[model samples]
Target chain A: MNFIELTDQPIDVAKVLQSVSHPDAGGEVLFLGTTRQFTAYPDSKEQDRSGDAGGQHTAFLVYEAYREMALKQMERLAEQACQNWPLKSVALVHRLGKVMPQEASVAVAVSSPHREEAFQAAKWLIDSIKADVTIWKQENSPSEDAQWVHPTNSGAAHE
Target chain B: MIQIRLFAGATQLAGQSTVELSPTDLPTNPTVGDVANCLTARYPQLQSLAAKSRWAIGSEFVELDCPVESEHSLAMIPPVSGG
Candidate 1:
């Protein structure tokens, strides 16, 4: 079964993995994305606007989505992945609402008859979701006001 | 009337989640670009976003010049940040 969901609750990685488990599948790959304390916005001049150009700390991140659109796009991506790979199943879950540091915000699992296909599909699914989904994240920083992160511009920075 | 939904920073800038426009406000058989131009004119704050954002009819993203039906759901999607 193909599974797709957007929820306010924390993502259950194990459940997502189990949902894609199949006897016919020889390989399964899971990817987890967690909220981090440091985030950098390379495309935006927001850092300068906040007067904290050198340092920015994320207290938390609040995720929001155009729900119906996001779900539809996700389902489309899942279908595309399945068509591109010989897969057993696919599961994708993204968390909405406030996600604290170190909390899992998204999870993806893909199972296939071989490791290569599973790995490729898993990577493609996550990358496509990041690039195409209609979800947004607001980074709340202690030193500066909150900013809505632009998809292509922002990335987690190790503190 | 057509309702244009806004999300993320676009919503924050416009100070409203949705913008309503009468068909008379746009050109005949308005394209997505025409709708965007009308919105920017009505809400100058949306100008910058309108320039960069993608347009969506219902759940599908469309080209700026794509024809829009007044009855369809529309949204201005700022750059997505999903994981």
Candidate 2:
């Protein structure tokens, strides 16, 4: 029912999971999201320099969020999940500021009396965080240019 | 008095994180609409965005008529993207 948040550093999924663990909890699920190195359009000018095109595609992403609102929304979502699921604990951590490619962007850890609830709650928290939270990231790449990415059904490039 | 917060592009323009205004005498409480008008008076640049901008009293999104007092932190949140 409690969540801790910090705007700096990469998220430690294990630490978050551990912090929310409970004696009666029988299932734990952890989700970690990392920045992808490539732009939505891989063939664009912002291609990887090392030529390991398949490697992490992003250089750095600047993250901004409505801190207070995000916290409250997260709390509400956790409470809803607890009500709908038999969860003993739910912990979500998001990294703000500039995050490098391959670095963790967000983490959600949930512990419940059953694996089904834990899994479902973890997935729901991540999805809702992405869709509802007022956090934004501008992708920075090797070309010294940055682009703001917005969600699209086609997953098209934002440029 | 009601405190207004600036964020993202709005913060960049305001040059400060927070601004305080006296919407009305204390006790009856000032509504978000009153706060918006006060914001426009203080920052003319915000006049246009005020109509569409989301207002947050503390952490929750509130309507213009929601009663807000001096103690709450009112913030202007522009559109943002995050995952």
Which candidate tops TM-score? 1
Which regions in candidate 2 have their CA more than 4 angstroms from the true location? Answer: A1-3, A20-26, A39-58, A66-69, A141-159, B22-30, B37-52, B70-72
Docking class of 2: acceptable
lDDT score, candidate 2, position A87: 86
lDDT of 1 at A137: 90
List the pairs of residues colliding in candidate 1: none
lDDT of 1 by residue, A18-98 (tens): 999999999999999998786655444654544444445899999999999999988988999999999999999999999
TM-score against truth, every candidate: 0.91, 0.71
Task: Give the alpha carbon lDDT tens digit for every residue of B3-74 in model 2.
Answer: 787765566567676888875633356688877877877788877656556677767777778888677888
**How do the residues A60-147 of candidate 2 rate in per-residue lDDT, one tens digit apiece?**
8988777778877878878888888888988878888999878888888888888987888899888877776767677777876665
Docking quality category of candidate 1 according to DockQ thresholds: medium
Q: After superposition, how far is residue B58 of candidate 2 from its true place, in Å?
A: 2.4
